[model samples]
Target: MIDCGRAKRPGWSPSVHYAGTAIDLLVIQNLDEDHVEDLSELLRTVTVRSVFSNPTVTASALASMKPDGMRTGVSTAHNVLRDFGPGLIGRWPDTGEVQVVHFYCRFGTHFTETNDLSLATFFRWGNFTILFGGDLETAGWQMMLRNQEFQRLLVGTQVFVTSHHGRENGKCAELFQIMRPDIAVISDDAIQYGTQEKSTQWYRDKVKGIPVLGTENAYGIRDKRHVLTTRRDGTISIAVGAWGNYLVTPEKVQNELTLGEILGAFGRNALSKDSQVA
Candidate 1:
């Protein structure tokens, strides 16, 4: 019920959606035409009810630019806040389902655009936490890693959606060591981005180490509740509607798997004597 994504370019209409049917809660991550697109039609077409975005230098620069260019983005973004109404977008405090909002309230050394200033959110149910990054990259990640608030707020994240589709620009080893999420979910359609094998392997070997689920890999295998990368072509299903679009939940692996279970398998000592780096 946030910003809805629409046809920004050809081939891909938006993420997890079809051009006319899918409505994404467009949390504007950046102003780079790729990430930011016409919101008026999208919001009205999808009848999106709300939105959330990080107030970044993009806003500041837009403030300085022509009024016509900034009107829709600012006004639409503002409307979401005004209508977030008296209650927060998260669940009631005591509820196990928690959607905590993390903002870049302060500026970074080179923070610019909603992209670098993209708002990152997390959902925590029990010990399981899933992060949905609105495209935050190196500068943004750096800001987060250095901030005391961010550090305290992000001590233990179970999963992360890597920013900028795991672009080489922001793949900092330190960020990985700090956040240390057990899994990384990259909801990317690689055809548009280019070869994903190399980049995917880079993070799998060095950063996430746990397991990576790409929208590209589509299949399900369950063993001891561990993550199994599958070929994700027809297996993944998505539905678009005025209310919202739904993607079929990734199938459980052949063996039962859980975050903790996977972590256990990767202990200092495994079935074998020890683990070997790829």
Candidate 2:
């Protein structure tokens, strides 16, 4: 029962997908590889029963990814069904899941459409809420906040993946206050683009005392910077770090606590007296 978690496997833990929960990503944009590299990895390994992507992937590119000539014989109109778009709904009876991934609203604007159309996703996992705000810009968050379904998915978030690598300019300050996450994961490598200071601070500060894991430092699954790895043998949680530390417990509080004054002496005294008596 992980009330909160990150991809911090010690010696060896099973893939999160095997934990009997759905995994969803809020794809914020369709640009560089850093943006989509993780996407490809997740798709390749995870048994994604269903996927929710914004109507952002270009038609040609998406078609190319499927097995050659996979979408053959389908008319362009019907192909659109096979191809997802903004405001699209698809059912997965095998998984018993319904997916609704939205794209940015387009009445006549291009600038707003791109940034605002970031894929904002919500996953229901065993009564816990997980929100993935893809490179969701400020306006996108605000707009979704007004929608009933969006608001419903956002309340009491457990794991909130920060958008755009936690950028500051995306007008995401309000997000810092609203989705007070218990634990936040920032999927950024040590690259110049994804780890910009202003961009990732919210992921650092959005939730008070939230644990933040940067990919560059954690999973050297790419660059040998992995602070830890899981064990496949025995208890399966045997993780030895480069710093000569072994992970005994997987979950640790990773945030700074800020305390505000309790103004009422009467209330404070009552709690103090109870603690002393106990």
Best by TM-score: 1
Off by over 4 Å in 2: 1-51, 55-113, 193-195, 210-278
Tell me the lDDT of model 1 at 84.
Answer: 58
Error of 2 at 235 (Å): 19
lDDT per residue (tens digit) for residues 1-278 in model 2:
11111233332222334454454422333223334333333434554444333444444434433333332211231243355653333443232342333434332333333345556666553334556666667777776676776656666555565665555545466665556655455444333454355444435555534222222354432221111111111121212222222222222211221122211212333433111000
Measured with C-alpha atoms, the lDDT of residue 108 in candidate 2 is 34
- Taking all chains together, each candidate's TM-score versus the true structure is 0.57, 0.47
Put down candidate 1 lDDT per residue, 1-278, tens digits, no spaces. 32334332233333245335633244555444345445554655454433445544433453433344545545554444455531233332332344455555334445534466566676555444556666676667776777776665566665566666566654556666666654455544434444455556666654344322222234542211112122332122212122221122243421334645434434422333212111
Count clashing residue pairs in model 1: 22
Give each prediction's root-mean-square deviation over alpha carbons. Answer: 9.8, 13.6
lDDT of 1: 0.46
The positional error of residue 257 in candidate 2, measured at the CA in angstroms, is: 25
Residue 214 in candidate 1, Cα distance off native in Å = 18
